[model samples]
Each structure stands twice: as C-alpha cells, then as structure tokens.
Target: MSETTQRILPPTEALICFNLYAASHGFIRLYAPYLERIGLTYPQFLVLLTLRGPEGEGQPQGVGELGALLGMESNTLSPLLKRMQGAGLLTRTRSEEDERRVVIALTEAGRARAEAAAEVPGCIAKDTGLSEEDYHTTLEVLRKLRGQIAGLDGKPATE
Candidate 1:
C-alpha cells in the first residue's frame, strides 16, 4: 500500500469494514511473536492493559469495569477473564458490598507480565513500517471513526 489515497476505493461498506478487520488482525499478528514471549494472546493483553489504567481512586478494578472499558459484552468477558485467572494473570473476586459484582486485579505475576509486554507497543509500531508520528496520527483518526461507528450506546473501543 502506498501512502497515497486510492483512486478507486471499496464499493461497499462491508468491503471497507472487512478490509479494516483483516488489516487490524494482521497488524496484531505482526506482534504475535513478541506478545507470546510474555505469555499473552491479544485479547488477554488487552484485558490486562485495561485494568492497568488509572481509575479515579487507584483501587483494584472490577470485571464489569474492565468489560465496559474494553467494549466487551459481559458474556464475552466471562470466559476471557476466567482464562486469564486460570493462567495466573489475574484474580476475580466478588465485592463484599455487592456480591453480584466481580472485581478483577492483577496478580504480582500479572503485573510483571503486563510491564514486560508494555515494551511491545513501541516495538510493534516500529515493525509496522510506519514512523511513530505517522502511526499515532493514523491511530487517532481511525479511533475517532471507530467511536462514531460503535456509537455512544456502547463504550468506546479500548485505547
């Protein structure tokens, strides 16, 4: 793909969406080897990254919070969280005040893994064959478009 705009774009919305979906996954695949060394699949890495965010109070985060922040449905999040927990990457517990709520926290092991994996962000950008500045600029524009498409009724996609 050249940096120039395509004279003939995709004819339909489905074509455009499918291309982006495939491209995004391909982009992640470029980082697959690096992420694997840290013991994270893309989704698992995303879950840890979400909970590592600075919540207002700096307290441990809950699964629902991660689910919303990550733009994941509860049903979808359950198995992912369970798998990560089983792998010792996270811990899920019910809040004493609210039994219905399941809080998720990084295990010491998880924290180290997250930190180790953090290096991949820059490395992956470098591997993309795009300069850091151009990469970030493109990411911002795409993020805005994704937000509009996803709609405010649901949470925005994970950063």
Candidate 2:
C-alpha cells in the first residue's frame, strides 16, 4: 500500500461521536423500563414530557408548533400524535380561528400519565451518578455542542 493509503483513522473509543452515540444508547437503556411502565416509547415519552411543560401546565399547541418544539417533521409527528390521541392522551382539533391549523392539548389521562412519570428524571439522574453541578455543566456543554453541529452548512442552530 502507498504511504498515504496506510494512514490510520482514529480508534472508535477515541472518536467523540462514537462515545456520544454509545452514551446516548446507555441513557436510553436506563430509561427503557420506566418508559415501558408508562406505556410510552421514547419518542412518545418525549412528546408527553414536552407537552407537560416545565410548569406542569401545558397549553394547547398547534401541530406545526409542536413539531418544531420536538424537532420533528410533521410527517413523523403526525402518526405519533394520532396514536397518542387514540390512546386518549391528547385531543386534536382544528383551530376556530384558522381551520387549517390543528391544535393539540393533553387530555386528563395525559396529565395523569405525566404526573405518574414525574420521578423518571430523578431516577435517571441518580443512575447517571452526576452531581447537580456536573449535571448542569454537562447539559450546557452538550447543548452548545449540539447547537454548533446543527449550525453547520448554514443551518440555524435554534431550530
């Protein structure tokens, strides 16, 4: 082989992307049992959490708006929303102001489910073994990294 052809790539363990991928999988595994008990998939759990909001009060949101918040395309979010609605977790209705807009609101059942899942983050945090400060720092770093990566190729990071 030529000298150029003999160049070696970084080992998988040394690659930040690989580490991040593995860490993500680890986190998912940690969340699996809790999510299963709640009868929600990871994506669905994310939707539920987002709709629950930080203040524990969720206002109705437009389909497009919800999709944007979740970083999901409407095509992907629509079927998930439909399934959630079928399970009586939420309601989808056309906006009176704009018939073209479909609004989503958590039903009573959804609120109850959200309440039941309240301890999930705490459980995951305990499993992570990160101190409060370290946890916040890690979150800040990850968010910054994600924003920078997303901003590549002239794409908006905040999206």
Candidate 3:
C-alpha cells in the first residue's frame, strides 16, 4: 500500500466529540471528592446547584420548570428527585395552582447542602489547573454554546 493509503487518525470533529466526553470525565474526577463530602453525587449536586439563584439564594423551583431548564426527561429526573427526597435533601410537593403539577423544594437539610457547596470553588482551585477567571469565562462560553445549540428563542427545542 502507498503511504497515502495508511489509516488516518480520527477527524477533528471526532476529536471534538471525544473531547467533550473526556472533559466531562475530568470534571467528574475533579468535582467528586468535593461534592461527595457534602453527600452529593455529581448528578445530585447538579440538580441542587441548578435550583439556586445568585449566590445560592432562591426558593424551591417547580420540577417541570427544572426539567425544562435541564433538558432532561421526567422519567430520568423523577427518580433522582425521589432519591433526594428519601435522603432528606429536598421535597417534591403539589403546586397550589395546578394540583396536577409537582414542585421541588430544598429542605433545611437541602439548604445546608447548598451552604456546604460553598467549598467547591476552593477545592476546584486545588484540583484543576484553570485560573478562576479562565474557569468562569470557559463556563460562560460553554453555557452560551449550549444555549445556542438548544435554540434559546423563548421556547425549548421540544416545542
């Protein structure tokens, strides 16, 4: 076979796709130790964190609203919410206006969990090489990219 016939390496797109997986793995690795101390798995922590507002000040959000924001299915998320409820970390209640819908709220213990999460930045500082500013900028860019991909025009892609 000619030299040109040799197998090519993965294409750039493939590399980018694999990079996302590897980066998520790296993030889990970096975040696990810190979050575990607060009794949260990565998914659970993400659920908790997403419920918060600026500086972790916010009321419990509705589960449908949370699911919509996370782009997750109720089938997948409902069980996790149940687990959180069992663990005394959060609550799922019926919405007053619409009894058919469920609302999710952090309990006192959930609030404690959020408070405990304040240690994450410091742990990340020790674990990851990215400077804080670089980290925040990367977060912004990634969120923007995600929003673009999700077609953020006042409605979710599902609609």
By lDDT, the best candidate is 2
For residues 32-142, what per-residue lDDT tens digits would candidate 2 score against the true structure? 999999888888888888888987888889999999888899999999999999999999999999999999999999988877677699999998899999999999999
Instruction: Tell me the lDDT of candidate 2.
Output: 0.88
Question: Tens digits of per-residue lDDT for model 1 on 30-114?
Answer: 8799888888899888877766654312257877777778878889999998999999988989999999999898888888777
Q: Count clashing residue pairs per candidate.
A: 0, 0, 0
Per TM-score, the best of the predicted structures is 2
With candidate 3 superimposed using the best TM-score fit, by how many Å does residue 43's alpha carbon deviate from the native?
A: 1.0
Shift in Å, residue 155, candidate 2 = 7.1
- Candidate 3, 101-151: lDDT as tens digits: 998988888878877776686778767878879888988988887778777
| RMSD of each candidate relative to the true structure | 5.6, 5.1, 5.4
Candidate ranking (lDDT, best to worst): 2, 3, 1
Worst lDDT window (10 residues) for model 3? 5-14
* Candidate 3 vs. true structure, TM-score: 0.80
For candidate 3, the per-residue lDDT at 102 reads: 92
